[model samples]
Target: MKKRWYDYLWIASALYLILGFFNILFAWLGLLCFFLPLIISITTGSKAYCNRYCGRGQLFALLGGRFGLSRQHDIPRWMKSKWFRCGFLLFFLVMFGQMLVNTALVFSGARDLGQAVTLLWTFKLPWHWAYHGGVSPWIAQFAFGFYSVMLTSTVLGLVTMALFKPRSWCVYCPMGTMTQLICRAEYRPERKKTAC
Candidate 1:
């Protein structure tokens, strides 16, 4: 498939990962990018963010297709089942809540903000633990939790590409689940209006 100009949005995820190493402020700021698209999805009943702007989704597409890393297989039925998608969504919600709490504590002057601000993949490894010295323990836990998600997604995306389609990960992505909910909510009213 031909790559569109918008496919460059995948770089945002890399940028976010990079920003994570510098300052929590920059990472938090990047959240605005998410919220804006979320709002648009709710209003338009479209997963515009996932399809057009999500960095992770874009990266998955790149690794699976353009990069020629995928095996070009078809996605399994079980993987696309609603149950699997909802489960992933629930898992993400819980983890994201935890990260939010720890980040909030850092913002509230309860933790060393400077220490809390650091890269995503570092500080968790034995050698890099020193990088997080003086930072709140819970904050690192939160960061690690997020990094786990990123790592899991990237790995799964690659695996799916090897076994199934390149975009197959999107079928089970938590972001896609959330966007489906948002778009479905907006869709219900129109269906009701037409039925009436």
Candidate 2:
């Protein structure tokens, strides 16, 4: 098969992680990853982003498929269950909500900027070296929190890739789930009103 331009997105995905590690502000770029999928799904009523344009998915395929890092085991039935996927989506949204709340607090001067990246929503890894003090507290706080979310999800994808198939993380990815939902809603049949 001929490789398309998007096939090289894995390099861009890897670079984003590397750049964000060295410059915390680069984390803001993650918003594109978060929004582009939904926009594509809504406009096209399809999951083209999740199926084709997802850089992280491509990265996992490169690592687990080309590099042979995956065990190639089937993902557990529970992990593929709709209930589990929805639950995970709910949990991910709650974490995102918390991140937004923290950013709002910093913006309001109610809380100081947090300089650490919270991994798995528990471990606070110091990331002060990546952050400079020139930016607004809220902006920097958002960067740190958003970076944590992106890094944590990437770690989960890597782990699942190693344990199961390379694209196993896609089964329950929150963005994938959201985009699926958006596509479904976009194409859902509507009841036509009867004229009086």
Candidate 3:
């Protein structure tokens, strides 16, 4: 198969991680990754973002498929079930909600700006060096929280990639699930009409 221009997005995915590591402010760009998929799914009523345009998915495929990092085993049956996918999506949304609340607290001066990245919502790793004190506290807080979410998802993807087949993470990815839901909702009435 011929490669499309989007395939090269894996490079951008890798660069985004590197940039966030060095300068956390760049973490705000992660919003593009979070939003563009839903926007595409909503507008097109397809999972085109997950199917062809997700840079992180492409990066996983490159690492696990080309670099042979994956064990190439099948993902667990339970993990592929709808219940697990929906549950994972729910958990991911809860974490995202907490991040928003934290940012809101900072914005309202109810809490101090956080300078650490919470990995997996558990380990608070000091990330202060990446932050410079010029911006508003809430803006920087959002960057930290958003970067944590991005990094945590990448770590999970890498772990799953190493344990199972390349792109296995796509099976239960929260964004993928959300986009799938969006696509289903968009087409549900059409399907009903055709059936009737």
lDDT of each: 0.65, 0.93, 0.93
C-alpha-based local distance difference test score of model 1: 0.65
- Report the C-alpha lDDT of model 3 over 18-84, residue by residue, as the tens digit: 9988889999999998899989998889998888888999999999999999999999999999999
> What's the lDDT for residue 125 in model 2?
96
The residue-by-residue lDDT of candidate 1 on 46-109, one tens digit each, is: 8777767777777777787788877887787888899989997797678677667766776676
Model 1 spans > 4 angstroms off: 1-5, 21-25, 104-148, 188-196
Tens-digit lDDT track of model 2 for 47-151: 999878899999999999999999999999999888999999999999999999999999999999989999989999999999977989999999999999999
- TM-score of predicted structure 2: 0.94
Error of 3 at 143 (Å): 0.3
Lowest summed lDDT across 10 adjacent residues in model 3 is found at 187-196
The TM-score, computed over Cα atoms with residue i paired to residue i, of candidate 1 is 0.69
